[model samples]
Target: MATIAFASSSSGLLFNKSKETSPRNGASLFHYNGLKPVEAKQFEAKGFISTSVRCKTVKAAVSAPKRETDPKKRVVITGMGLVSVFGSDIDTFYDKLLDGVSGITPIDRFDASEYSVRFAGQIRDFSSTGYIDGKNDRRLDDCWRYCLVAGKRALDDASLTKPVLDTMDKTRVGVLVGSGMGGITAFSSGVEALVQKGYKKITPFFIPYSITNMGSALLAIDTGLMGPNYSISTACATANYCFFSAANHIRRGDADIMVAGGTEAAVTPTGVGGFIACRALSQRNTDPQKASRPWDKNRDGFVIGEGAGVLVMECLEHALKRGANIIAEYLGGAVTCDAHHMTDPRADGLGVSSCISKSLEDAGVSPEEVNYINAHATSTLAGDLAEVNAIKKVFKDTSEIKMNGTKSMTGHGLGAAGGLEAIATIKAINTGWLHPTLNQNDLEGDVTIDTVPNVKKRHQVNVAISNSFGFGGHNSVVVFAPYNL
Candidate 1:
């Protein structure tokens, strides 16, 4: 019942003014602690009004209708969490985004003299120790930490604590989260301790804590989820793949509860130097804050970023039976390969278009119904143009689609890109606002649709998609629809 402030948008809900927020207005329907029901309704005939000791107020009702096809297993988002330079919630993040405030700064995670681009959009104030219990922190890596905090926050937000699978039937519960580059930081540190110091100094838990899949595995361990555990690697599309696979799992009824999302912590010398070697990073070192200017005329390349995004996906009957909050619906997803190049997309965007078409089919929605699109506009010349062309192909009529990218604000998060963008899409649905492409000074190349630029625009978004195409010709698209039932 503590006083808290919250702002809602089609994009997402944000509690920016305060870090720890009171339960939202609608949580009262479930655990408001403000009301109690009487077993006997016969007294109602005597005009005796039922008393509710709880003071919580009902602000609004959430109505998500179940699908007639299969009622028990509709995919619904119960909770979401985000960690970026933009702030935890979507609005705080979008505010920093619209102002063109880049989180990129001088490399502070580690020394980077040899790396051409040392600056990155790193979460300087973040600490994994806080995400994990202090006692268990030593056994976890940066990747696991990011996922842990975000995942914990999501479960809490959903009003569902980590399940005690041992005490309950957990075969229906699962977890899946990916990292574009996981444990690279831990790997770098372990090698230093092993070679420079001594093999004895190396921790015994190096490998499990450092692998990409351990983040999700640790989530399962911490929360006691025993359904499924897996990690996916797709360079930058890692999170999208996680979301895609999670949606499919729900569709197949493989799991009723799937903790899904992605985390990335690859801003070390290995992460920065390797990308620089590929000539894929921006070199606006003089102006680090403005370096990540996506869809801009002067865009050099992408700015490295590190963070995580997490979402709690549950089947409709499960959420309804527990009276959990429903944030959004995961329509479905699609994945494809370019088969053209390892690090470059096809010039004509043939593969990208196919990915979009496939995702639309998976979601059972048409391109015409898609109102907003979170593009993989990393500010690169070929990548930007190619994706736009692909959008044109799949959308058929680009004039109606509202498109933009969050990278201009948070920088390219490599593997975390898809996960963070998915959070952005959910925020858009919550707030009904779409961010303008910051630093896009000019409408260059071929932009057919309405690319919101310079300022944030508010509009209704019933169905939206987020695109993440990573290196090795990996392309992923996820579609989310506002729950109608």
Candidate 2:
């Protein structure tokens, strides 16, 4: 049933009209009215407006949330692919995360002794030997290389090989991979050539390879997917935005399948130097592994990471017809802008809180249903607390909701962060084990909620929300749950 909601200033309340439902524990899940204007004033001192609904009780049993019955509108993740610091395989990457193995290491690709930050979660010895042709493999930027390999790997995971793909309708498939710093290496090299040598020294492939949409375009061209193809460049939130948009395309009947996610290879000299100039990188060169401590009071800044994560998203009917293995279901997602700062998050965190609320409403789930959160905790002082504060506004009792930070082990992957984290969320659903947020010594006072610190915990996640907030106050949240037949 379609949900309908109404709000009036005179009434000072918003109420939802939907079917009443009960959880596995036989406790009634009430659709409470939205927060009143008086409740909104709670955030006045923090510099933004916010509203929230109160939950009645906390349930312990894990049960799947309401899913769309219509096959065409229902979106499922058939495959997940990633080129992480650990490796290119999904199981290996997730296993490392669950084991609390830190991937951050000293910058060895270039001379970085003079820089403030000398370490990152850089992918060492990445190769596209079998994926791309010899000539194009060497010529393409790492950003392009990462996405191409990840996207193709995702198709393989979906069981859509060359012979299988040939039988499917090519026009009904699409690609929507994104990158925040698109072709930074190529752009930097082209400019260096123009400055040091001359205009004649510039490479002819500079413009074509340096644009943001080239990754998506090339993936489509290589796979022969002729439907909706484009890229979103919303910094850290790029992957979730792509997933959200790609799922909607399937829901709207524009496409039957999509290769969607984000990629970023910004571990180059220019990328590291730019973050250093902005003072956004941690200089804990002595302890690079423990540098990305999200809720730790000793954290100075975020550790840079680079890689790609892609997912093969398909409609339910399409998957059933082909006898595909479904990984998880894409419930709903929402994006919002803080409209407050370029690099800094809003002190009040109303933007993020609102985005989470909207995502839950769209998913036809309540705050009580979400027992896990893959938070966008980047180990920065203000960012970690701001995200936690925002989360408190939506979830008053986090005692039931366990939140963790993926950046603690992998560092911040910028555009690729959301895609990597989403894979972690789905893994948690399938494995019933939540990875620990490492290096939680001297925890922040305001962060009282359980972060599952230092060790993995066995917990059945009913509904999980993965958040990715970026520069320019772009906030995004995507909901995921186990796929049940």
Clashes of each: 19, 0
Best-fitting candidate, scored by lDDT = 2
- C-alpha lDDT of all candidate models, in order: 0.71, 0.82
Q: What is the C-alpha lDDT profile of model 1 across 81-164, one tens digit per residue?
A: 777766566467766765656677888777776666778888867655445788787656667777888887777778876453
User: Model 2, range 220-326, lDDT digits (tens) per residue?
Assistant: 88888898999999888899999999999999999999999999989999999987655567778998998999879887778889889999999999999999999
Give me candidate 1's TM-score against the actual structure: 0.82
- TM-score: which candidate is best? 2
Give the 10-residue window scoring lowest on summed lDDT in candidate 1: 5-14
**lDDT at position 223, candidate 1:** 80
Off by over 4 Å in 2: 1-67
Q: Where does candidate 1 stray beyond 4 Å? A: 1-68, 89-91, 98-100, 127-130, 162-168, 197-201
